[model samples]
Target: MKHIFKNGIIGLACLFSFNAMAENYTIGTGSQSGTYYPLGGILAKIWSENIEDFDMRAEVTAASVENTIKVSSNKQLAGIAMGNVVLQAHEGIKPFPRKMDVSVLFALYPNVVQFIVPADSDIKSIKDLKGKRISLGAPGSGTRVSATNILASLGITDKDIDAQSLNYTATTNAISAGQIDAGVIVGSVGVGAITELAFTHKIRILSFTADELKKVSEDNASYQSIEVPAESYKNVSAFNAPAVWNILIVNKNMDTDLAYQMTKVAFENMSKINQVISVTKFTTLENMNKLNGIDLHPGSLKYLKEQM
Candidate 1:
């Protein structure tokens, strides 16, 4: 009887040790009011439900810049970031505080630039934004960086515009209250904030001309020309929109098995996710192959190799 009790205690100890070693990873997502947050929530739910012995959760962050920082620090196992910003972060560019250990899991989708202005507002064009109060998205956000670059390409600098560094919610409120003339957001079409704003206010989306689009692509290698179909918003007409890509990144130090499982879940569910969100329609195996300049996590690469 004594020997049996001792063996039972030892078995319990081993089981507890194994359970303790099981990892629960968190994915750093964007603002609560944005698409990334919802998408990240969905991903976490799917992963936790489908992947064995691994738990996942979504953390609200200041978007791409903050996400990269968290991933680099190993506070997050994975994150969602704008593609261009990911490149910049890896290189320790102006916005990123330091070099990051960010690596790609996949290229998720394009984050099109949508500039919303009051219908009666005189800001009919990007060039007309001069001297007008505009929300350039939240501080330390990829949207803010993209807005800055676009304005600079058009010769509209901070000195030329009344820049309000506000988040999507704040910017939406400012525009509704007439506190600002325009608000710039980088999100997928059919964004919740933009949709809600359109229901009550008449807004216009200023589109980039072909020449301006050309110039933007030439200026930033990370940007790509994309089209935002008409009827994406109630108040906006369909137009050819130019925008940048948003990528999914993982911490370099993440456990290989965990990363492999995560990547496998993402690709395997891509088809189903696409059916739910049209933005995901663009996420294809070919596009994954097109992603450049970033190293794939070794586990992710192994999965990709098997697919090939």
Candidate 2:
């Protein structure tokens, strides 16, 4: 009986020790309805499963800008953000109060800047959006920054349009309800909000003209030219759009070993992650260099060197 009691106590102690050793981390993501949330969840799960005693959770945030802010402040261990947004933060550009200390883990995929309106609407081009009500995306979101910059590039300022700050879902809802003439969303090609909005309302994604694309890209080096396929959305034609890479970011001060382990595990399980999130198909070693000037975390750098 004494032996049995001693063994049971030993088992309990072991369990307690395991629990005590577990470390929890969080990755900031966008709205629950957006791509970042699910993608972040999948990544957190992957890292947690592969790294014993590690628990990573995805926290809902206002998307890129907020993610960068949180990650820099150490409110989040890491975050998913657009390349431009991270660049802005790193450089202490507008919206960011000061230079944020963050480093890139890797580039995930290109998030297209989409401008949507009803198919039959007279707003044929971005120029037509002048004097019209438009949603620039949620406050503090990278979508807003992209929209604002694009508009500024075209000489369309806040004075030129009635701007509304709404999130991905809200922007779609507002447009569907006729509350806004057009809405801007920066996300994966077939973002859930835009996809769901298409089922109930015939919509068109406005393509950027060559000159306009050049202007936007020139205005922001982080912006890239990408073509959205016709089949990406219902009844929407293939469109030329400005895109920015979506990157995984961490604080520069993150433990070197922890960052290395996380980066290594993520790359090793790319196939598994891609199976769950198609956009992650871009999360390859080759794409890691597409961080658009953001410094790579030392841990991730170490892992990448090993791959070479």
Candidate 3:
């Protein structure tokens, strides 16, 4: 970080004394098959190609909630997580033990709540899931938390269905083998897990009623209504569902100059990142830096202000 800030600023040398070695870093992303991993790969490649000596890599783990925890605990490591999970991490909500010192850089995309079943199945609506086996997403993931809340809003509880905590691939396999009735996935508009399922088995996406959507909105401010495009996947058509915003987050204690540099480099080459994952379309200069209830990193804030 020697050249991160121009010389002659007061206390600059003292500040650099502690933040001197800015070498290898990592971003805690989600599963390799999910968007976060690829998104991280794109950013890492861009930074290594465009910037100097910034050796970065993507670490696959649980998507939102785990990413938030890792970012809060480690200063050098950043994360890609859901907006609501980031908020929960910073505020020390139900899932978090205590308030975490975290901040956001830019917004990602939305995690569309998907309830998928075999195309020919008779499970018509959320109501039909009673006494059926369903995967609610792997434990400690944002999908699991969102799945539970979404079901609660729809008047479905744990007792109403046979709950299974499984990841996307596991859920997909179970549904394919007829071991489960349906699988709940929370990802972008055309998540790979559901799309992959369409290859071997006919898939049907369930739509949330307008009233159900309203109830979800009232219960969770982070989620929004969305429509999956028609024929986005094989043997599957369009459907409406609720979605949650995903964001790139970092520890507030991270080096401000490094954070600023990362933010600037990312926006300068947003197209490269977007090419790898189309969901980045939701991230924009107009509002990328804005988060729900958490603070934005001071360096990221500076970069956004200057871009204007």
Stretches off by above 4 angstroms in model 2 are 1-21
Clash totals for all models, in order? 1, 0, 0
Model 3: runs farther than 4 Å from truth?
A: 2-22
lDDT of model 2 at residue 263? Answer: 93
Error of 2 at 219 (Å): 0.8
lDDT per residue (tens digit) for residues 1-308 in model 2: 01011213222122324436566678999998789999999999999898767778999999899999887777787899999999999899999999988889888999999999998899999999999999999998999999999899999999999999999989999988999999999999889999999988999999999999999989999998998889798777899999999999987777677778889999988898898889888888988979656678888989999998
Q: Please provide, for model 1 over 217-239, each residue's C-alpha lDDT reduced to its tens digit, 9 standing for 90 to 100.
A: 88787878877777788858776
Put the candidates in lDDT order, highest first: 2, 3, 1
TM match of model 1 to true structure = 0.90
- Enumerate residue pairs that collide in model 2: none
List the pairs of residues colliding in candidate 3: none
- lDDT accuracy of residue 260 in candidate 3: 86
Off by more than 4 A, model 1: 1-22
The per-model lDDT (C-alpha) reads 0.79, 0.87, 0.81
Ranking by TM-score: 2, 3, 1
- Residue 209, model 2, lDDT: 96
